[model samples]
Target: MSDDVRNIDDALSRITAYWQPHRLTSINDYDVKVVKIHGEFVWHDHPDTDELFMVLNGELIIQLRDRDVVLGPNDVFVVPRGVEHRPKADEEVHALLFEPKGTVNTGSAGGEMTSPLRELP
Candidate 1:
């Protein structure tokens, strides 16, 4: 898609699968992505890139090595590079992610939650 206004709610509504990230747009060397998720994600660390997680719906708890950060709708948290963490939710949550292009969902600790990049819905 070309540069244009985007409604994250509308974009999030179109997602059909959990944990599958759909790239919404790109800026410079980063890609903006949205995904639907629930439960706990694998513990991983992006050694070279920080990850932004912005909650669009529901709630999420980012479990860090030292503590947990709780996020609700409209909340945003940045997990620093090389900081091991895991995301967990009791119910389904919709969220946006901003990180460098090619930053995997599971980071360097690849696991079942690792997702292939997908075109925007």
Candidate 2:
């Protein structure tokens, strides 16, 4: 991390791929990342850590085992560790994720949607 000022929207605009997270910075052992997502994501859970999701644009539905949590712009939600969850979006969504460093996009049920964190330039 540097003493640099970055525009979130401008940085988000450069992210061309969906469900792919671009690292913005790091604090302690966690990373702050931005991602563009559309369609439905794979159902999975981080066994070792809780995942935080903050919707930057559009709406998102976090599907949990018992119920679904709907999130709107500027909304924040944390899926507790070991909880099975799947994120679904009918349209495109811009969001930020805060999790431990090297947390894979796809957690335990890793499949095609898994992605290594992409660092911002």
Candidate 3:
């Protein structure tokens, strides 16, 4: 990918799996990843990195340690690092995730949803 390219639509189509992220673009040490998510995700938190979730389609409910944030299309929220969270959607949801380059999706609690590394589809 070229540094000048920033077409999200083109990046979305290239993504091929659930929970898996396709590197879209990067700003300094952070990278944006386009992901397609459905159902429920495991509860976890990144001890040293904040996670930004931007909904592109459908809806999502982010369950936090204290409250839940409902997100619709174009809605965005950030889960601060070390704050436990779980993402759920009644139907298929497309979202753009932003975090530092080496941030893990499932944080320290590696399980089924954890990807070895972020890759471009």
The backbone clash count of each candidate, in order, is 0, 0, 0
**Which residue runs does candidate 3 get wrong by more than 4 Å?**
none
Number of backbone clashes in candidate 3: 0
Per-residue lDDT over 1-121 for candidate 1, one digit per residue giving the tens place of the 0 to 100 score: 5468888878888899888898988889999999998989999999999999999889999999899999999999999999999999999999999989898899999977889988875
lDDT of candidate 3 at residue 63, scale 0 to 100: 93
Best by lDDT: 2
Error of 1 at 111 (Å): 1.9
Off by over 4 Å in 1: none
- Which rank order by TM-score, best down to worst? 2, 1, 3
Q: What's model 3's lDDT at 16?
A: 73
Better of 2 and 3 by lDDT: 2
lDDT of 3: 0.86
* Residue lDDT tens for model 2, 1-121: 6577767898898999999999987889999999998999999999999999999989999999899999999999999999999998999999999999989999999888889899775
For all predicted structures, in order, the TM-scores are 0.93, 0.96, 0.91
Model 3 TM-score, all chains together: 0.91
Candidate 1 displacement at residue 23 in angstroms: 0.6
